[model samples]
Target: MPLNIDFQQIFLHLFNFIILALGLYLLLYRPVVAFMDKRQAHYEELDRQAAEKDAAAQQKLDAYDARLKAADEEIQRRNADANRQLEAKRQERLQRAQEQADKLVEEARKAAERERAAMLEGAKKDIAEMVVSAAGKLADKEIDPAADRALYDRFLEEAQAAQEDRP
Candidate 1:
């Protein structure tokens, strides 16, 4: 009444505003807030599951790495063993070859000595015959068998003495 305003209308409008605010809070704001909370909880659960999966994946990777390292070590060890075996085999083969060569050389030496002995025996027989023929020609007679043997023995002894004196 002081400024030509109606106090009853103003009071009624204020009451209507209060009712509208309460209705909006119950119908729209409350549901929206609940939905946001549920969404946040869902996202948090998803993140936790993802973290668990990552941890499991890392554990599996570590296991694979360990196995791979072990495999590599095993391979190296096997390779070393194989190399040692190969070296041993090579040494054995070399030793066998050397022994074989020595045996062959010794056999050749023995064969040569035997051949030399046989040749010397043949030469002695030939020299004896030649000396006997020459003595028969010089005597100009058919000699007795015992005398021929004695002459041959004397000639061989003289030839051996001459050879020893030479050089």
Candidate 2:
């Protein structure tokens, strides 16, 4: 049982461990960890900006859709009003044309009635004059002019009485 240990060997082993740790931190571990942290922070900032931009674009699209819908409704209302006004004007023109046609027909009927009455009156006057002239010719020799005139007047009176008695 000898308690004999090497101090030089122990000191050399401790120095080697410290040198190995420093090399690992400087060449491999610290650089990789720092690069990973920087990449994570960049990706997070990009994701946040993308989300904000998407929300803004969505709001703009919704406002545009609402404006288009309002414009379409306004056009529909204008078309309906125009159709109603056109129909009203058409009806008014048709009614005016019908009224004018009715008036023209009425005027024609009145003209025909007036012409028929005039013809009837003229025919009656011609018949009366012919009867008086024939009676004067028949009594030319047997009666004076004044007496023949009186006789023709009496004949005309009797003729009117006979016509009245007939059915």
Best candidate, lDDT-wise? 1
Tell me the deviation in Å of residue 108 in model 2.
2.4
Model 2 per-residue lDDT tens digits across residues 1-167 = 25656787778988998899999999989999999999998999999999999999999999999999999999999999999999999999999999999999998988888876776676577557767777667667665789778767876776666556533
State model 2's lDDT: 0.83
Model 1: per-residue Cα lDDT at residue 71: 100
In candidate 2, what residue range of length 10 has the lowest lDDT sum?
158-167
Error of 2 at 149 (Å): 25
TM-score of 2: 0.61
Q: What value does the lDDT take at residue 29 in candidate 1?
A: 95
**Model 1 lDDT on a 0 to 1 scale:** 0.87
